[model samples]
Target chain A: MKLSLSSSPHQRVKRDTGQVMRMVIYAMIPGMIAQSLFFGWGMLIQSVIAVISALVFEGLILYLRNRPIERTLTDYSAVLTGLLIAISIPPTLPWWMTVTGVFFAIAVAKQVYGGLGFNIFNPAMIAYVVLLISFPAAMSLWLPPTTHAGITPSFFDSFSLIFTGFTTSGYDVTQLKTIADGVTMATPLDTLKTGLTQGVTYSESLTKPIFDGGFFEAAGAGWGIVSIAYLLGGLYLWKTRIISWHIPGGMLISVFVCASLLHLVNADYYASPLFHLFNGAVMVGAFFIATDPVSASTTPKGRIIFGAAIGFWIVIIRTFGGYPDAVAFAVIIMNMAVPLIDYYTRPRVYGKNADKGRGKY
Target chain B: MTDFRDLSLQGLWKNNPALVQLLGLCPLLAVTATFINGLGLGLATMLVLIGSNVTVSLVRNLVRNEIRIPVFVMIIAAFVTIIQLIMNAFTYELYLALGIFIPLIVTNCAIIGRAEAFASKNGPLASAYDGLMMGLGFTAVLVILGGMREILGAGTLLAGADRLFGPIAENWTVVLFSTENPFLLAVLPPGAFLGMGLLIAIKNIIDAKIAAQQTVTTEKAARVRVTAES
Candidate 1:
């Protein structure tokens, strides 16, 4: 009788790392498009700069380390890192700063930690944190959406602004900070934070021109569109089995549950759960950063715990911590705990008896 | 010679006060926002180190072993007081800028560590030299790390130079490129940690390269021996 022998119980999966990474890139497209439409061409320019820089830096480091450069480049992890960083940064960030961020993300955050699977923190989030802390002025320089300002920067202008630090017409970024009034618009989250601290009520704070057009109802206009697009992408990821539901579900539930409790206790002091959900980077973080396969927990229960912890930390830090937006810090903090979570929450082996303790037999 | 090299290497890399030994981190992280800040503290620590090491060595045989820690600490505190007064007299601006760190040097582990490990066993001359080398090494790292943070964070170098070197380098601060705002992360405590981590990483890479070269050479020699025997 003829018999064939193969590797034990082997089952090949059709999807590779490249495909998975590419799907994420594809999913980010709608959000990127929304951002461009509302915000301007700066995000697009930054995205391109980030992707190219990430690739080049990744390639250089891999070559220096004697790793297979082509194989590492093909996985698209670096591209994903770049995209996340690009989206997080102010669209008008100078070209060199963007390059510096990408290089740091790839070289220090990813490669220095033994690269890829070995990295303890999310590379993109690290870059965001680095940029946010380092260049607060540039990082906080968010232009009013084109709808509000009636000025949509041309692609060439954005490109020039990024590369040369000036608009095509020779206006520096500082001059372009605000549009109609002396309002001096800050990000919605930042406004809320500063406003609350200055003894302004939540509702009163939302009355600022920055939140005009009934947009803060859905997290202001431009950011709301971007958030919804990210949510759609996240749902697609969940449905397609690209990611499991544990992290997103857990994170969203924790945020809602925590925000609801706080709101109930003091309605005037706290924003609604919906406000917490739709505003800032919570949706993006819930779907994207928390779901990072490498830094996040592996086991089903562990993933839930990890996600919930991040959500909880986000709310706590946002409310009590120094920073207005705490998603990046929260995610990085929880990233450190994944291993312990996975260790304790490991599922039982399929055939092992449930009652059998370590000392039993 | 042996004591000096070992102490210098220990302070510089192997047993770095800030990195490996994790000593005096309060001042290391706090005052390292700029090169002048770090240099000022580093020089202060160096003076204290030399004074304490020499004093500790001189009294090594006189003090009872049981009461030695307190004695060593007292000596360190005394030296720190002297350094503080000198700085307050000459570089009052730097003394003010460094603030609590100058007084806090009395509690720095690197000072007491040398007193315990090297100075307690060696003669005064050797102990003093060891303290000098170790202090210089620590100061060098501080200056380098401070420079990196200042340049990246503020896009300037030798910021606050007047505080350390006097009015000559005052406004000697060249704006490498003016940003609308400085990089806050680099100025914050986290930036200090990250900058220190990168410095350590660079040191590790150099060590790894040297180790790799040694292994290659050893393997080549082994191969040559086998071939000759065959």
Candidate 2:
């Protein structure tokens, strides 16, 4: 005699945490490569430092918490968190800073909140905000893209600068940021904001040598290629069905709409939609950071609301607020509202019409 | 003896005004930004608690039940106003620093809680004792929170000691580390909430450990009794 167990649905989605985390890690490769290619290979060193510290911290925390260390290590969530933080930070960030950030991300942000799925905020973003707030100068230290900086940090120089704060030839990280005109180049968004604040028009700001690029003009120096790479990775995640399209689609469209409206109203005051979309962390934030399943709105309609609000916040904060780029602030602020969004945007019961969710008769 | 011990224990740990009872959180969180600020506010609160407790207990028998709360509140307000005036006269710097909080201490739930719960029922001596212990307990938490926020936020301990102690204290500030970057987040209001949370978590851990030890000792006693019976 044979016994059989059958169900209506015969297929199952691949629901392994380790596998999903591995996919995310795999997806970030193109973006990381693009960042290295443009910014310098210091991103590579930061990633390595972060990953090592993250694994050690994760393992140590798991040991202290009396959990299975081997099982948790296999999950690769720590690696992914470290990777995200590494990419989000300035590549020339000190090695110790990387260690500190990863420790906060893994031990405080992730493990303290009871690990991966239970974390209330995006662990990477929390550490990013902490570092940005605590060490503003170091956090804003972005190198000019290699094409503009006229001198890229070789692997050894990048290595020495990251670990020892100076290169082989005794050049400092700040020196690496200088161009031929003796000006320490700033990020495109920062340049634009500073210029506009100084009463320069949008076109006048773009004329700065920092904005000189063949294909990267729409984006900042290295940031344009980096953003494109992140967009590609994000699209890959969408294609593989690893992530849903609602978040990035809603975020990008809303950003475009908001920027277009403000730009139309006052061309000199607001940057164009294209500028807002391509510059700084907007591309990466919409596609990668805001789409974290645990912290983001889970409901379909809620996701749209969450994404659109973040987009609106990014634009509002960037144009009028003190900060130049506001992706981290916008994401964290919207994360606090995810619960409210999800509660209101709940899907109706199977037998009930969607009107029930809206409290309509 | 047991009554005083129990009252002291309740004030210090079991029904702690700051940690356990969670009373007077307004001042507990607000003035705890620095050790001196916390210490000053704490002393002021303690003095008011003792004053109100003693006065309320002495007048408890004469007051009507319905009118007692208003009377207790009035007593607390009077003590707070006197303390405010004394602080303004003597520690003028601290008075300015802790401006609204001193007056606001009149509304501190800890003072009225004692007046309503303990002072109204007990003798003046026990009420005074309760007030002292509760005040000390509250002061300890504020100092701890303040010290923690001070150290983490600014990498200093007992900073601004001159504000509370006097001219000699101007040089009493303890420096643990120095940095140019403003650890501004830790000095902000959010730091108060974080510090309070950590303090509460620590209190809970101590509570759980005490409970566990008590259970183990009682089990040992029971086992000894069983063995003796056998």
Candidate 3:
């Protein structure tokens, strides 16, 4: 009479979806602070726009689907998606474009595929790719880090630029990007790719003002610090067991290996492994985007394969492909292969030898 | 003979080649970037369908069953060639714009599918009617999908109309809005696929609504019957 009649063994993780998402958002704060200090307040403005629009779209879809809007919105998945997209894009992107991206991410990419868990690809990345392909000019308009530019755009200036495509003083993003030499500053990756394409060696390309800290010191001036902050966030995620070590571990190792091999072959042509690790969105992508529990490989061994393949593709695409950054493309490509990866890497049942033939039974 | 009304409904909505049967998607997706391109291709395919259906029906008995596929294909190929020649002579610009697709129409599954399924069994006149209706269904889908893509991709409607019609039709192009930066995704192959998918989804929604209404009416009638009996 005293024995409880529950169906199965009962053990549960105390953290809910909302709690886990909150932790992720907290982890991103360090990186966000770093990004703001270096890239200006445009990122913060973009994040606000994205989050509001994302929440609105999420609410609308939940209402249409006859689901509980408040409870689902509390989970903060849409907020995280909005944050990811906000951080990934050029901060000077117009408000309408940011809203368009958030709409597609929440309404089309997430809800159309039956909401958060059922989505096949990362919604934030899909939105980024869509915006990038649709408006190539706007997508690549990055402001030089404030540390190098010697002028951090005021919050009002960034807000005005995002809304009206110009600051109150009427300086456009293009004009702002112009450095002391009148050469328009670009991202470190963009400068590197352009240099290499124009027949400049890797070392020669690093001599550009964007890599002011020296060739081997860091990826680029502010980029390296922002990447380190993200790495710290990622390590926190790993230590807290919020994300397993397999995906990020495999990704970092493979990126190092691939970049090392190429660097060894021709030091002048290929950048070092540290450069690859700290440059662009590679760190954020490896730790945050690719570690998405829904889209990424689930099996222990499959996660390694998934992460490693993504790293390899990132190097290949960044070096040889048209786009300077390859994180979104690589993640989306690997998302398509998750089903196959899972099928082959299934864990063996207890008392059944995986190497033994099934016919022996 | 099948009722003309029933055949029209089947062709236009119930058993649409592009939306339901999903046949001839190669041409449907490939050439639908502009309205004129779609209209030109649709007309050519319709003509080819009509000719092949009538021809297949006429020779239904002479060709043996075992080799019927080869015979049907030959008839379809001949019609495609005739249409190709006509377009080449009349609409040279549009013809060139469509490029390899006109010849590739011979490989379109919808034409051969109708010939084998409907034409080979029906009389010549009935087969021709079916061919026309089916062709109309396929063409409607192509035009709609093309219009969707063109408007979104380029912000214009009936663009390149002069290539389809004559010089007077040049002004027929309607400018919805002009943008320096066009939505390139809508102009690409992926846009064609997404447009096609949305069209099919819309058709299914309409069909489902009609079915639901019919069920509601039937249920009301049954409830009245039970009330009367009680």
Candidate 4:
């Protein structure tokens, strides 16, 4: 054989699964810190629990399926799923519930669909929604941010509450939800939604004590700060080319256009565009969850359509539907439409005159 | 004798109506929230199937080819009406529980399917046997699916047994465990789909195991004959 001068590794491929996954995990760091700082140590503890369980389940399933275990674990998809599930849930969720969500995320959502890239739905969102639907009472138990509540539990107390559903001081999660004024502490979006449903105007809903500490009337105290943190992290992801801008751009534009129109029509009924953007999971979802490479649409045009539709659904569901925050439902719904969107949005080949939307001859 | 065994096997497993053919899925998913409800609907469906099958088989030679479908539908409809009236008069609670589904049995493609594909070409005895076996197969799935939904969703078995088996069976409800939050998903329609998907996955796993075993035998045949000689 003739001597070859080719160097090893042939060539380095950019954006491998592991690299992309690492980037995603890195992007979530600032957001996670913000969530824990504002919410408490509950999310951090839950994240630890979820990541551990997710890895365990992932390893177990791979072993059962008789595959290379190390290769799958190093991908960090499980870690990201754990991270997403951890942050998305209410802080006061019980330990076993977080474990249940992780189990469902890895075992059913990922493994049963042939694992990782083959999954049909976003595993974390599916697990979150399943937990939400299954345990509505526990899923809705959010402790107000430390800034608003003024009652800080030590790290150990947060751990005890999450693990045992009670603090060492004998106060349960429900007790933690009630502020000093005897009113239950709800998520800013939840409080606003409830107030509006009770026939309060948009501006009046903002006048409640929950919004008392905010510089603006759009988002609740501590929530807007968290959203801004996520937005900064999301922009970093975009700048690094880890995530494309088509989805986020489409989503924000649609939300802004839709919210402003509705607000212009009847400002009494609709929240302003700024409020909609900063509140709930709007920023995080537009940046992180909706941009999930596996479940999101791949084509350029399909991406825009997919993101716009999710934004549209978020507004409709939040304003009229039963739920207060709707990013999970909206993203899952758009995930279902990915195939049809991709089918219709297939790009035309050069010098080809075919007009079939299905990309078939 | 082989034909009889084949028919039985086809109905019970090989060609199960609910699991394989996926016929009459509405009642299969709807009424399968409880075991007794499944049994109630299953028995009613079996009665209609047997009656319609026998009648269709007996009159197969006389009906004209062009109007055969309409004639078969009419016969099934007649039996369904009789079954409905009998259910109304006797088991009123179950009748009410099963309600439109009992009347809706006339639309079950399994009954008409057997009438057209099997009974119309077979003798009355075979047709009746086919009906009995197929109906039992469907009932078995419904019963199993119902059992899953009930046990998982409500933490109880036969919770509504009295609807079918009378007041004496009311005490048969067994609480698996007491929990303030019953897995409402299992009793909900989504639970039915999830349970069904799991079942299908289980069947596929079994099939794969059997296939793997078959392949293992062939591999074993090629084993080197060491026998302390190598």
lDDT of each: 0.85, 0.88, 0.91, 0.87
Question: What stretches of model 1 exceed 4 Å from their correct place?
Answer: A1-12, A174-177, A181-183, A212-218, A350-353, A356-361, B1-22, B167-177, B205-230
lDDT of 1 by residue, A273-293 (tens): 877888788988998788999
Candidate 3: Cα lDDT at B187: 82
Candidate 2, residue B158: lDDT? 88
Q: Considering every candidate listed, which one attains the maximal lDDT?
A: 3
Enumerate the candidates' DockQ scores in order. Answer: 0.74, 0.65, 0.89, 0.50
Ranking by DockQ: 3, 1, 2, 4
Which segments of model 2 are wrong by more than 4 Å? A1-8, A168-180, A214-218, A352-361, B223-230
Q: Per-residue lDDT tens digits of candidate 4, residues A1-361?
A: 9986877887754677888989888888898898888889988988899999999999999999997899999999999999899999987788888888898889988898999889879999888888878788888878887887847777988999988778899898888777457877787678778888889888898877777675565778888888888999999999998889999989988888888888999999888888888888889899999999989999999999999999999888888888888999999999999999999999988757755555766
Model 2: per-residue lDDT, tens digit, A194-230?
A: 8888999887787787777736565656677778888
Clashing pairs in 1: A133-B184, A133-B185, A134-B183, A134-B184, A134-B185, A135-B183
**Native-referenced DockQ of model 4:** 0.50
When sorted by TM-score, best at the front, the candidate numbers are: 3, 2, 4, 1
lDDT of 2 at A158: 92
Tens digit of lDDT per residue, candidate 4, span B94-113?
89988799989999998899
- TM-scores vs. true structure, each candidate: 0.90, 0.92, 0.95, 0.91
lDDT of 2 by residue, B78-173 (tens): 999999999998889999999899999989999999999999999999999999999999999999999988887899998878878888889999
Mind giving the per-residue lDDT tens digits that candidate 1 earns over B76-157?
A: 9999999999999989999999999999999898899999998999999988888887787778878988988898788998
Q: What is the C-alpha RMSD of each candidate to the true structure, in Å?
A: 3.4, 3.3, 2.6, 4.6
| Clash pairs for candidate 3 | none
Clashing pairs in 4: none
Top-scoring candidate (DockQ): 3
